[model samples]
Target: MLKVQEIRELIKLIDHSSIEEFTFEHDGSKIKMKKNTGTSVSVVKTVGQPVEIPSAEVVHKPVVQEVPVEKAATVNAEVIQEKVEIESVTDLHKITSPMVGTFYESPTPDTDAYVKVGSKVSKDSIVCIVEAMKLFNEIEAEVEGEIVEVLVKNGQLVEFGQPLFLVKPE
Candidate 1:
C-alpha cells in the first residue's frame, strides 16, 4: 500500500505535469490515473482482482480568498442566537450509532418508538435499533439522561460513530 505522502506526491506530480493519463502495474496490483477536463482526477486501483468497476474521481477545487466588505461585517442577532444554542448543546452527551446500518425507532412498525425527545433513559435502556446485514441490533443509551434530540429518522442509514441522539444529563 502506498503511504499518504507518497500518494499526495503522486497527485501533485500528475497535477503539475502535462500528462493527461498515467497507468502503472506491479506484482498483483494496478493503478491508473487520468486528468479530465474538469477539476476532478480519476483514479482506478485494484489488487489482484479481475473486476472492472467505475473509477473514483478525486476533486480538487482551487481555494478562493474571501474579501470582507464593511457592510457584511455586521453580524445578525439571529445568527448569534443560533450559535449560542449550538454551543450550549455541544456540552450535552451524544449517543452515537455503533455500526453502519439502518436506524429504527421501534422494534416493529406497529409499536411505539423506543425513545423520543424529553424521554428519560438509563444506561441500559434501548434507545433504538440498527439493522445491519438484515440483522436487527438494539442500541443502548449508555448514559443516564433525558433524550434531547433524535438525530436520525426511521429507516435512515447510519454510519458508525454517527450521532444518533443528544441527551441532557439528569
Candidate 2:
C-alpha cells in the first residue's frame, strides 16, 4: 500500500519538473503515475492480483494538505494586478510553437528581436524563430494584432502547442 506522504511527495516532484510520466514497483505491487498535460493532476491505480485484503480497505490515504503554491503566489495584489494588465492589454490570440525547439525572439543573437510587447503586427508577420534540429523555422502571426505578452523567455526550449505570444487583434 502507498502511504499518503509518499503520494504527496510524488505529486510535488511531478509538478516541479517537466517529466510527464513515472512508475514504481514493490513487493509484487506496481504503481504508475502520470502528470496530466492539461494543467491538472490525475491519479490512477491498478491492482495486479487479488489479495486477501478486505474490499473496504483503503489502499491510499490523503497526505498533509499543502497550500497550492501557484494560488498562494497569486494572492498578492501585485501579482493579480500584473495578470489583469496582461489580460487587458490583449484579447490573447496565442501564437503557439509549431515544433519542439529552442525559441528565439530574433533571427540572430546580435539583431533586435523581431517583435516586442506592444509591437503592431500583421497576419503575415514573422514574429519569432524556433530552432529545431539545426533548422530555424520562422514563426508567423496568423492574425493581425499588437504583441502583448511573451510567454516564453528567449533561448528556452518550447514544446509543441506552447504559447509563445499573446496578441490583441487590431
Best prediction by TM-score:
2
Tens-digit lDDT track of model 1 for 66-99? 2333223244444545545855876689999999
What lDDT score goes with residue 160 in model 2? 96
lDDT of 2 by residue, 60-160 (tens): 42222334335444345455567668877545799999999999999889999999999999999999999999999999999998888888888888999
lDDT agreement with native, every candidate = 0.74, 0.77
Pairs that collide, model 1: none
Error of 1 at 85 (Å): 0.8
Candidate 2 to truth, TM: 0.57
Error of 2 at 108 (Å): 1.3
Write down the TM-score of every candidate: 0.52, 0.57
Residues forming the 10-long window of minimal summed lDDT in candidate 1: 61-70
lDDT of 1: 0.74
C-alpha RMSD in Å of predicted model 1 compared with the true structure: 13.5
- RMSD (Cα, Å) for all candidates, in order, is 13.5, 8.1
Q: Native-vs-model 2 lDDT?
A: 0.77
Clashing pairs in 2: none
